[model samples]
Target chain A: MAFQILLNIAIAFIWMLLKNNFTGVEFAIGYIVGLLLLFVLRRFLNFDFYFRRVIAVFKLIVLFIYKLILANIDVIKIVLSPKLNIKPGIIAVPTKLKTEWEVTLLSCLISLTPGTLSMNFSEDGKTIYVHAIHVPDKNEAIKEIHNSFEKAILEVTK
Target chain B: MTEIVVSILILLGGAFSILGSIGIVRFPDVYGRLHAATKSATLGVICIIIGTFLYFLLVQELFIGKLLLTILFVFMTAPVVGFMVSKSAYNVGVKLWDQSIQDDLGKAIKKAEKKARQ
Candidate 1:
């Protein structure tokens, strides 16, 4: 716990330094505020095996970056065509992620991507309804979400 | 010359973003607005980021790998986020303001229900 506090302080200090505005008073205040928030949040959320989850989150972030670049190219093609040939539709993506936070993050990721939009989650949270601008194959699209986003989420949460 | 090109890209990106926001405000339906915003916003953001990277390269004579990382992240996530938002809106009964289309989803749901019953 003490190590975690030190790590957070170090990170905050580095960030402040990078911005070239590191005042001692400001650093101390910011460090304390950040530490307190982390401590409180830690008590509230039961993230057992913290290091593993953090690593998984980092991996997901990396994967998301890779996907973002590809999606941009896809969107550009769709936009520049003289006659728009988009096959837009809604799909029910069955989510295996258990936690609300994981589901929310996955949904947010889905929404952030250019061609896909998260329409809704079922009442029981069994499925997420998503609308894709250019879904060539529904099964393939659902599989992509399940394998890419939900799989990463399951790694973090479970 | 490179600086001018970078500035032009940055300006173009800003223009795209502004046009997207306008589309969002002006478009009749949630889906239409989303279509406008997501595509334009992504392009705009990418242009701006590239411009920044070029500027940094000119000034510092070194590339910042992290800017590329930021671009990659934005490119991947924007569409997925857009899809999710539109889906959620549809589920909550947000209707198209203009009335000139068939809901293929509704038809598919009905067909699936019939197949399940058999």
Candidate 2:
């Protein structure tokens, strides 16, 4: 991962020198160009892992932003409503995520959502404790986490 | 042409900021307020940053690096800071809403205390 990042930065700087523009748009374009170059030269450069990781991170960010919009709208609705009909409850979500970085990413994603907050890990770290503001059903909540946040994190990380 | 889009973005950013502000003020307790403060407020800031970036890009014809950096920094840090603040709050027993239906952490804290005592 570290080596790939250095390679990417190196490519970006090379791109900057080639393009003769150091602006953000140029930098972004250069980055994409660098990414494509890496991808095309994947076998030669042995940068397949870096290439995949970059793409995965991009997809995760897109997914997070899309969900973030929904989360904002959902929270705004709940807040603007007459009766604060929130069924706030804590649920234990079993996680396949093991490593500290992945777990931290997962918890931060969970916490960023509108109504949910990650509270604690179980004694074993197998189960994550989450508090949702309107958890009408525990199973549904768990499934949602599994399908979206956990799945996205899994794809981005190892 | 670009003016219309920039105006729309600015308005949307303002609206998000307003909505989040209302939520922070009106939401019941620390936990509920956090719901607004973290998610909505962060989104609000992002929207504003994006709007500012576009404005700088389109109007001034200067692609400033600092605005982009600010957006990137906020994206990386806001959720993290929010998570830490709320986690510490719960740990130190800042009250959840009166209507909160679960106390999983409370039980866990109690169990840990009992284990520590023994």
Candidate 3:
């Protein structure tokens, strides 16, 4: 990732030097040119381009924001309702995430998303214990976690 | 105008923050309260920060990058803090609400212990 960024920067500088146009717009054009050049040469490179990961991260952020809004509305409805009709519980949510950072991210997303708070992780890190405010069905809750946050996380990290 | 938009954002943020506080008070258990506190509060903070950012950029003609940075920082850290607090509370044996429907973690722990015994 660092190498990809440094190479892109180097390419941008080389383009500026060649064009003798050192303005921000020129630099941006140079960067795009470099980005395209790198795209063409990606097969020769051992590692993937950094921007793909960046784009995935951006998508994850957008998805997170969407989920955040939905979650807040759900919580607001629950809180404002006449009665608290919730079946709060802690459920074991198994994850396929391997790295600690990915698991931590998954946990954070789970906590920040609707109806769930990540309480603990299994010793193997393959499972997260999530406390959900409304667990109508354990399987359904698990599936929702797997479908939304876990899937988005897998895309970013893997 | 920009003023109206900013005011709406700030008001929405305040409402969410107030709701979060109410949630914390009304929730039955630590975990349930955390569900209220972190998520709503993070969104509340983000709303306020974006309002500030928009106000500066549109009304004052000043673009402060730090406001954006602050939102990102808060969004990332708030849940971690909640997670830590809940985990510590669990470790301290703070009980789950009696009405809670399940405790899968306890089951997992027991299953692990049985394996160790075998």
Candidate 4:
């Protein structure tokens, strides 16, 4: 992943030097051009892993964004309602992720989603404490988190 | 054609920002307000930044590293700042809404304290 990113950046630099247009659009075009070049050279470079990882990351981002919008709408609805009908609570979620970076990314993802906040990790690092605004069924909510965010994060990061 | 799209995006971003501010004004408690600011406000800011960047990318014809950096900075910092604020509030014992249904954290704290005292 890092190598591919570095390659993309190097291509952009070369493009800027050639076009003499160091603007954002030019850089973006350069990125596309770089991607194409990479595609053409894939057989020699064996860039299949990089391509698959990039696509997986994009899919994970899209899924997270979709959930974020849905969660935001839910928060807006709760706030605008005549009565405050929220059932706020903290949830202890045990995680299979063993690395600090993975746990940090998971926490960031959780906190960004509307109506949910990632509080802290247990000292042992095996569990995270998340606070959510509208959890009716704790087990179900945990299941959904595991199925969507956790799984997608692991898929992309791994 | 690009102008029209950027304009609409800018409008949508402005509207979300307004809604987020309204959420801040309308919410009952600190947690509610945190929800409004962190989620809606972050999205609103991201949208506006993205729209502005698009405008520059297309109409202005200047590729700006700063614009992209600004968006990335906001995306990374906003949620962490929000998390810090909420964590401080919770640690200081800012009460949840009276109608809140659960207290898993409170329970956990109590258990931790008991373990410490033993």
Proportion of native contacts kept per candidate = 0.23, 0.69, 0.83, 0.60
Residue B35, candidate 1: alpha-carbon lDDT: 66
Q: Once superposed on the true structure, which residue ranges of model 4 sit more than 4 Å away at CA?
A: A1-48
Tens digits of per-residue lDDT, candidate 4, A78-115, equal 76688877777778888888789888888888888857
**TM-scores for every predicted model:** 0.58, 0.83, 0.91, 0.82
Task: Give per-residue CA lDDT, model 2, range B8-108, as digits (tens).
Answer: 87788788788888988887777777778878877777777888888889999888899889988887787677667777887787887778777777777
Structure candidate 3, residue pairs in collision: none
Candidate 3 at A38: error in angstroms? 2.1
Cα lDDT tens digits, model 3, B6-82, are 99999999999999989998888888888888988778878998999999999899999999999889988888898
Task: Point out the worst 10-residue segment of candidate 4 chain A by lDDT.
Answer: A46-55
CAPRI rating of model 3: high
Q: State which candidate, 2 or 3, has the greater TM-score.
A: 3
Q: Is candidate 2 or candidate 4 better by lDDT?
A: 4
How good is the docking of model 4, as DockQ?
0.56
Candidate 3 residues A6-57, lDDT tens each? Answer: 8998999999999998998988988999899989999998878878887888
By lDDT, the better pick of 1 and 3 is 3
Best by TM-score: 3
Clash pairs of candidate 2? none
DockQ of each: 0.22, 0.61, 0.83, 0.56
Tens digits of per-residue lDDT for model 2 on A1-158? 78777777789888898989889888888778877777777787654557677678899989887888889899999878988888787777889998878887888888877578777777777878887889878889889999998888888776
